[model samples]
Target: MSTASTKKPPEVRLPPKPDLELRLDKFAQLATIFLSLVGLLFVLKTGSFLLAPVSLAIVVGLMLAPVALRLEDIGLPPSLSAAAVVLIFVLVTGSIAAAIAAPLASWAARVPQIWNELQLQLQLTSFSEPLATIRSVREEIRNVTGEPNVTVSVQDGSPVESVAVLAPALLAQVLIFFASLYFFVATRHDTRLAILKMCSGRRIRWRAAHVFRDVEGLVSNYLLSIAIINIGLGVTVAVVLWLLNVPSAPLWGAIAGVLNFFIYIGPALMAVILLGVGLASFDGMPGILLPPLAYLALNAIEAQIVTPMTIGKRMTLNPFIIFLAVAFWLWIWGPVGGFIAIPALLILFALARNLIPGFPWGMPEERRRRLSRLP
Candidate 1:
């Protein structure tokens, strides 16, 4: 009688509700994109030896593409035009290397002395007591843990051995770079056409075409403009350092120019380097402070004024975005990554504008005003 009073069947498990399903689908898509990005990054990092040079080649090719086209307009064949461009590039690179070699070598020879001086200076700082306390604590921890002081000796290989190990890979990468550059420059037009033809629809083809055109134009203009600005900066730095009686003026100038390409990290590093240079060269605190402060002032002017004017608002990027890009690439590929970060961002921006519907280029003043009117 009690059992008969009330026995009900179990409730069946229903499929997810429509809203829940929709959310799950969106989450899956996001996860897929994230995983794909991680995979791409892994490939890029592991294949850096091959990919790094190839990436450099692609960026250089894009930058030099207009020059190649101009040569072709003069009735030069693509092969010869590309060759000429590559040759010019090689010559320019060689000249820069030669120019910096002597001063760089002199500085390299002074590394040990510099290190000692740097250590002495650090010990003179207010933080030295805290550093000493930290070192003592570390020693005490090791003693308490009964960990023996392990002397791990690494034998230095012969110079020839090091070079021999490195040279083949370096030569291969260099060869890959030149070959890739030459072929890319030569086939760029055909390559664009080929990509367009592969698209399944008129809309797709149109987008592809714009992507190519925008990428080339934007990258070339941005790089060329920055190059001009950096050259001016370098020259100004050299003159300033020379007037300040700093040794290796040209070397520091070149370093400044090259490092400036890396955005935030570069200028800060240059300041630190200049501080060290000052320390090595002069005895007074005023001397140590002068070089970094001077450079900082110049950098502030360039960044706040000249760069904006030169690059224009259209080409200008968000500072936070640029910083993130630099940090990500620097982590992935070292200095080379930093060098190519902006161009790569430009390429992605071009792609996004073309591929994404209603994606704005530059977010014009009128558009921005309209956006500002929104709740």
Candidate 2:
């Protein structure tokens, strides 16, 4: 009976193993990064109304920084210089818009004619049967559902009404853009100093300074060079189109130039637009093909030869990476996102290379070594 009363002690539970703890810590870090990225994307999309214009202003400010600094060097105050720069930019943009307006208005006035032409041309193709079948099916479905065709009359949703609704927001964004540009320009130097001063250590401060320098140099040079290249490309497009008797040659050229900024998507869109232009202008195959084909040839030359020469090897970025960046930004912010994508990538790359010692993933070996050697 005494022996039977004896009982075993309870087993002890040991703490988690070191390896398990390490894995959990790593997972927590990953989770934090993922959450941060998600939050950032959410903020960018939701706050696009403010963020988009500010982003654009910052890019524009960087492009014009050299001009602002030059003005300051010539004894103009930062405020005055910023104002002058902004005014000049507005004038240039307005001039371009004005140059485009008359042609655009004329073309818009001919939309019905173009639509008819497009329909006729499409009917002449193999797609006619498929399109007709789809239309018939749609009509049958509408009938079955007892749904009348929706028509937007002037009272319902006129362009004027739409513009009136949107104008205030547009005006506000414009004001925000201008104000952001002015302030960024005025405070550029002070901003740099302030950032550098906030660094915790000498090495970190040095890296930060280089990051700023690299960002300013790369962005400004890339933008300025691109601007020059696009102007040339635009002029070339205008002359070629004019020679081909394409209507609104200057307008198309200007559109081409502006679109060229978006890289792959832009050129492809321009081609589609030119195809539409071709269909609108000409009745025969040669006429229809000439505009797009000629533009393609010119674009090929510019992209392959002139652009590389102008921007230089140092400014070159991976095409795939550029496309991805453009896609991501465009998805988030529409056209403004597309406009800022390249600059944003450049800025990110500069920061990464300066701040991280082994960030040579996309860099050339020599360049990576060079960057690694930096303090």
Candidate 3:
């Protein structure tokens, strides 16, 4: 009897099961989120004609919003504020176009001459191997595919016809961009209030407010800071190149400033362009390398020193994330994708901080500092 009593085990305890309705609700929520994301990406990829302009407009508007707000604070109407911002933007763009249009056209005119020089130089140097490998690969592919020795030619259309074909689409995009930008700026307050009102609870409204504020502040401040830094970079490059006797130094500087916005890819492309320009404009290997090398040095200073001091980590994103965003958008919409990638990241991260629990994006200074101290 004693042994039997001792053999009795403690009463077993079981945890309460999750409610079926609650589990089902969570699954439904997750599924809805997944489907919404898929649909959004599909629309973005397929609707570039409309979406790209809208996206660019939104980013531009976001950046210009502070100006609009300042104007409003100064007793200007919303419409007037939006108009002033847009007009200023137009003038800035026009100035940039005027600066580079002639140089770009001249370069385009010299492409054949440049190509001839490049070929001649390559033959006399050790840099032709890569091109030779490409040709050899082409021959191998032709052999594999049994290619026909047919020559196909494309006829150049009249300039008028080309313009006629192109102008409407470009005009449409411009109009859409202007319209979206104007409306977005004009409705800034109304839009924010509407967003808050749409949220069902006080917590959600507060989060929405944070997201709206952060997105506007992050995109505007980052763009403004970078633009200021790039302006300095452009002026530095222009001065350096002018001293170095590079033709169209200002144009190259302008190009550099614009391309620097693309981060790594822009600089590499700029280096290659400068290399070609140097080779075309000067003689000997040393002369050919000077411009690009100088640019690389200046770029190093800006990227390493100026940008970090100016931008800090307030809106700093992982390079991998930016690269992927650029690559993804590039696949969808080419150059426009590259321009919007950073802005898109800023907006997404701003929203993520407010919407996603335990997520690290747009983290506060204290939290970020704590993270930096971790192993």
Ranking by TM-score: 2, 1, 3
| lDDT (tens digit, per residue) of candidate 2 on 154-236 | 55778899899999999999999999999999998899999989998666776788788888888998898888899999999
Runs in model 2 with CA error above 4 Å? 1-16, 133-156, 300-312, 361-375
Off by over 4 Å in 3: 1-36, 103-107, 128-148, 154-160, 300-312, 361-375
Residue pairs with clashing backbones, model 2 = none
TM-score of each: 0.82, 0.83, 0.79
Span of 10 residues, lowest total lDDT, candidate 1: 362-371
Q: Put the candidates in lDDT order, highest first.
A: 2, 3, 1
What tens-digit string does per-residue lDDT give for candidate 1 at 236-348? 99899999999888889998897788777789999988987888897766777788888898889998889877775657677667678878888888877988888999998
RMSD of each: 9.2, 7.8, 7.9
Q: Candidate 3 has what TM-score?
A: 0.79
Pairs clashing within candidate 1: none
Residue 186 CA displacement from its true place in model 2, Å: 0.6
